[model samples]
Target: MFNIDLFPQALKSDENGQTRSCLLQQTTMGESVTEQELWFAYPMNLPMPEDDDCDSYLLATLLPAMQLRAAIRVHGSVSHELLANLTELQYVWSKWLPERYFLIDIQVDRIRDQDLQVESAIAAFSGGVDAQFTAYRHATGRAGYATRDIKAGVFVHGFDIPLDDTEGFNSAVEIATQVLSDINVDLLPVKTNVRALWSIDWEEYHAAAIASVLCGLKRYAGIGLIGSGDSYDVLLTPWGSHPITDPLLSCGNFRIIHDGAGFRRSEKLIILSSWSIGIRNLRVCWAGNKHDKNCGHCEKCVRTRLNLLLAGVDNPACFDTPIDSSLFRFMVLKSDAVRIDWSLIRQEIIETGRGLEWLPYIEKVLKRKSSPKLSGLFPFGSKRRMWVKKMLMRNK
Candidate 1:
C-alpha cells in the first residue's frame, strides 16, 4: 500500500522549474531527474486550484513521482516498475491481483486467477455520468465480454477539476466512492501543490505524458487512460485537445485504452438514465459552483439535458437552471455539425441502408478500420470488421 500520509502540505519551485510540493522534508528519492521531478510535482495536465477543496490526497498522489527525491527509511524493494505504466499497473494490481489473493471473497463467474493481473488502474474518479458510466461498464463487462482479467482503482492527482473550483474534486471523490462500492480497492492518493501549473491554457496530451512515466518506471502490462471521449472529439478549443485525437502529442510508451469510443455521450446518458443513478448528484458545469447545481443554460449542461431529452429519460431533481436552445442552434449551425447531414446519417441508419454516413467517418477518425486513400496525406486505418459491424449498426 502506497501511504500518502507522510507527504507534505506545501512545496516551492526551484529556479530550474522543478516543483517540490513538500517544503519541510524534501523527497528522499528521484531528486536529480527532470521528468521525474515534474511527475512528483503534479501528475496533472492542468493547473490545480488553490482553495479549500485542495487537500493532502492531491499532494500524496504524486508519491510515485515523489520517490524520485530519495528513498525514505521505509524497508522494501521499491519495484519502480509501477512508474512506467501508472494506469495499466493500477488496473493490474487493483483489479486482477486482489482477485488472485482472495478468490472466494468475490462473486466470480468467468474470470480466472491464472489468466492475468495488473499493477494498478489509473483513475482520477470524477463522480459525473461519463466517468461513472465508464467505470460501470468496465466493471459489468463490455458487450457481453466479462472483465475477468480487468480491474479498477483510483489514483488521485491534485489538480482541481472545475476550473479552479475546490468542491469540484470533493464532489467527484464523494460520488466515486459511492460508485466504486462493490470493487474493493485502494485509493492511492497524492498531495502535490500544482494549482499554478494547471492554469496554463494550452495542454495537449497530459494523459500520455503521465502514462509514459508510469509505464516506464513500472513493469506493468500497460496504462489505462480514461476519458469521456466526446468532450475532445466534439469541442475544439484554444487550450485543450482530445486524448484519442492526439496520442502522438505526448511521449508514447504505455498502452492507453480510452473508453471514449465504447459509446457516444448521448448514448451513455440514455443508458444511465435507465439505470438507478443518483441523477441529482451529477455536476456538468465547469463554472465551479457545486451548490449552484448544473446550470442547464451552460453548453455542458445543455448537452446533457438534450441527450436525456432525446433519449426520453426522466429529468432528475434539478436545481433551478434553464437550458439555452440557442446554444444548440449555434452548435448545430456548424458545417460539420453532428446532424448537419441528419438526412445523410439518418438514411444510413435504415434497415436496408448500411451505416456508411458517419460510421466510415467515425471509423477513419477512431482508427477502428482502415480505408484506401490517395497518398500518405490520406490516412487509411485498419478495417477490423467492415461488413459485419455495418450490418449490425444498420440493422441490416
Candidate 2:
C-alpha cells in the first residue's frame, strides 16, 4: 500500500517569497521503496491549505496509487464528500483504461467536516485558447446565468512550463497576468514539482494534478473551473480532463467544473478575437522553447492560425511567424484529435465560404499516411499514434 503521511509542520516560506506545503510519501510494492517528499508551492500572498487538510493529497495520490495497483492509506483528515466521490472516480478510471489503471482501496484516518457555502471560483489558466474562452465568457457575462464568479486565474509553473524554467515561467505569468487583468481578474501564481517528482503518465494524470493544486484554495473559494480542451461534440475520452471525470474530483463544498465544453474551438476563438486584449495577448504554442512565443510552425500553431483566419482576423499579431500552405507539407496529423481539428476547419471553411485556399492543404495533411514512429520528428514530440487512433475510433 502507498501511504501519504501529513506531517504537522506549518507552511514554509523562503527568501524568494514562495510558500510551500509538504507531505512525506512512502510507497510499498513488495519491498519498501525510497521515501519522497511531495510539495506544492504558491506565491506568499495566495491562500493555502491548512496543515491537516488532506483533500489535495488524496486526489493527487489517486492516479499514482492506481498506476501501482496498490491501495492508499492516508494518515490525515480528508473531506467526507471527497471520499464518497473518489469511489465513483476509481470505477470510471478502471472501466475506461483497464489495461493501465485499476480500482484501488483508499483509507483515511478521519473525515474532515464540510464548510459553509462558497460561491467564488478560480480557474486553471495556462493562457491557452480553452482557458481564455472560459475566463472571458464568464467575465464578460457572455455565459449569462451559467457564468461563474471567477475570482482569479491560477497559473501553475510545473504543469506546462518546467519548474526549472524560472525565466520562462515568469515571462508566461506576465502574459497571463495581463490577459486576466484586462478581464478584471487577478492572477494567482503557483509552483510545484509534482510532474517532475513522479513517474506517472502526464496525459491521463494532468486533470487530477490540476484538481489537487486548486483544492489548496478551498478555504478561499468553493468552486474550481478547469477549462475544457475539446467541446462535448468532439469529446476526447480515455485522455485526461474529460467532463465525466472532472466533476468527480470535487470534494466537500469545493466543486470542480469542466467549463467551456459547449463551444467549439473556432467558436471560442470568434468570441475571444473580438476582445482586443485577449486576442492580442493569446499564448497557445506548446512546441516552442519555454521562453519563446508561438513558433508558428507547429501543428497547433498552424491550426490556431487557421482558426483566427476563419474568424476573419486576416493576420493575427499573436503569432510572430506567418502560417503558409507550404508549412502543411511538414505537418502530420498524428492523432485522430489532430485530424478532427483540421477536418473541422475544413468543414467550417466550406460552410462559411472563406479561407478556401487552404482546403487542399488540410485535405492532404489528413489523407496522407505515415508511420507512427515518424511523428517523433515533429516539434511536440511523439505519441502512441496508432494506439490513440484505435482508442478514439473505438470510443466514437
- Which parts of model 1 have CA positions greater than 4 angstroms off? 1-120, 143-168, 182-195, 198-203, 209-222, 231-254, 291-293, 318-396
Tens digit of per-residue lDDT, candidate 2, span 1-396: 554444424678776554545565565656575666667877666666677777887788888778777777777678888988999999888888898788887877788776654679999998888899999999888988888899999998877776656898899888888889888999998877666666676778899999988998887788999998888888877878999999999998799999999988888988888888888877888656544367677689899999998888877888876667777986787676677788899999999988999989888888887438443332121245334534644552
TM-scores of all candidate predictions against the true structure: 0.46, 0.90
Q: Model 1 residue 180 lDDT?
A: 67
State the local distance difference test value for candidate 1. 0.37
Minimum summed lDDT over a 10-residue window in model 2 is located at 373-382
> What's the number of clashes in each of the models?
61, 0
Best by TM-score: 2
- Candidate 2 lDDT for residue 35: 62
lDDT of each: 0.37, 0.79
Alpha-carbon RMSD of each model = 16.8, 5.8
Cα lDDT of model 1 by residue, 270-296, tens digit: 666645553555555543234225645
Residue 266 in candidate 2 has what lDDT? 87
